[model samples]
Target: MIEAFDLFSVEQVAFGTGRWEQLGGFARRLGSRSLLVTNAGDPGDGGLVDRTLRHLEQSGVAATCFRQRGEPRVEDVERAVAAAREQGCDLVVALGGGSAIDAGKAVAGLLTNGGSVLDYMEVIGQGRKLTRPATPWIAVPTTAGTGAEVTRNAVIGCPEKRFKASLRSELLLPRIALIDPSLAVGVPPHVTACSGMDALCQLIESFTSNRAQPLTDAWALHGIRLAARALPRAVAAGDDVEARTQMALAAVISGVALTNVGLGAVHGFAAPAGANYPIPHGAVCARLLPPVIEANVAALHAEDRDHPGLAKYAEIGRALTGTCDAASDAIEAGIGCLNDLVDQLQIPPLRQFGLTPEGFADLVSLARKASSMRYNPVTLSDAALTEILQKAW
Candidate 1:
């Protein structure tokens, strides 16, 4: 018998090759003025940002642009929120990678809630719940990763505290998630590889999470299969529309699955590591994926042989390798496939990002406190977590 579960997702999603053209209409429905959030490095120059501006103008919707430099910092959200309020903007549209979307999400949420980001953020703040609906927001992803468009939480980095945490609330879910695979074309190969691997890791980890439910399991497996088949193609040929579309869909599915069922050790470690290091979030997840999988499988085998995650890992292995072998062999084969993919994608080791043995204790201690870790398939000891970190290093 299946256990009870809950699923949360965006209110609406518009996905296709030409869906970007509908952004203006969507924004107009929400408000006449919008705050357009994009990457700091995007110089317009007739690029995607310029195109978006044109779309909003054509629909008679005025926009003020806000560029987010990196991951959503608490101050970034504050600045954007102030800009939106100053401009009397009623709608928020984020058009870039995960950072831009997360920044926009936080801005939208705080616009109505009327407080600092710290008031609603988890782990490093007051953890207050958002009592009001966020300003209407739309998410347009320029990369096929993160699925931040549909998620309800925004990750905000606070450099002063040397940690990252989430500002979470159901109100943060976007009014519309507009995904156009054509926008992902021309993304650098390295970015594609890292983002694709992040999607894959989320799928695998969510599938094996203790919170896995029937719907999430289905979404996870389907996404895992799509990522396994499309990631290499997307990395090899950035202009491949089919590969980009598949990856985009897989990423959205991953976001949905993880939002409902939660994630495991990879994300657990990614939280603290990303906050403390200069490494990119996707790259950190890519480097740790294989080692975390191995550690989880080992811990499960040694402790709870009958845990459902063991079979789930075998299923993931089959998805990755297209193999119909015994569970043990398939699990190993799946892990081998991940290692090979990491090598093929040229994902750098954790050590390359300045992580050393001396820091393992702190990382493990922080990881234990990560909300994602509670959803791991098995309870891993400090020694096991340390070993995984060392191997990734």
Candidate 2:
């Protein structure tokens, strides 16, 4: 049987050591007036807000900066949209981590579309399809994680609803993705671990996803190999340019793959876990990935011995460990390798992050409702889900 799928990515990707130097020229082509969104706590840190403004100024483009304080929220998008509208900005440059890029994607969509961010969020909002083209947005990632630079959806956390949802549309894809691995040179080791694990999980899950297609599979496999070799090195020495560049490439590949083929239980659970706790999205993914992989393998074998994802896991095991084994044996070896990586990264358990058994019911229910859950190779029962959570705990 033939499977059909669609691929979406940013229009232009400029990836190299100092590609950020081209920002001014690119901004001029996009628009004369721009809005810049960044999550940097300080103006001088990896937060390139001031530098981005200088680039736009040098290009003769008028620019305004909105510094996002934390994770993207519904309120952040609302405020950014209003800022863009008031300043009459014509372009948006998101230069930071995932939060800034996600927020910029939302603001760009809402700026031209003329609606609140809630009008298009999944599960909790009207889920209206966005029809208008977004204002041209350029994404410059300061981190090597959360390929929001290329993905088509912005995750927004709504405090009032106590849930995190995504504002999605093809229009939300950025006009350009400018990835400079040098920007990640000084990122803290802890942040590196969490983000790197998220990138790795994205690659592994997408490769074995129910929606996996030949195109995504190719990307995922390559990304998995890169991440396996680079993530540890990057985490150990943040200044290692070679490792950082590989991790960045792996992250972008994972993002493109997940956007097309979808993710699995780790992200499915992370969505709700992140909303209910103060944990970072990447941290949530890191904590849950090993258990989710183990559970998926067990469930697939117990329920349907011939499910193809089982073999895919073996392939993943081979890709990660560079060891050849039978599919069944490889799956166990892969799980062990993943666990080793998790410990090496020092990904804390859910308990340390405030996920208690009392919260299990709501977490499981919300996890199931997440759109990502649909792509898991097997439908996990409530009991199975509980077991996975407990194991992670």
Candidate with the greatest TM-score versus the true structure: 1
Model 1 local distance difference test score: 0.90
Model 1 per-residue lDDT tens digits across residues 50-94: 878878988999988998998888999999999999999999999
User: What local lDDT does model 2 show for residue 117?
Assistant: 84
Model 1 / residue 241 / CA error / Å: 0.4
- Count residue pairs with overlapping backbones in model 2: 0
CA displacement after TM-score superposition, residue 157 of candidate 2 (Å)? 0.2
Question: Pairing residues by index, what is the TM-score of model 2?
Answer: 0.98
Task: Tell me the spans in candidate 2 whose CA falls farther than 4 Å from its real position.
Answer: 44-47
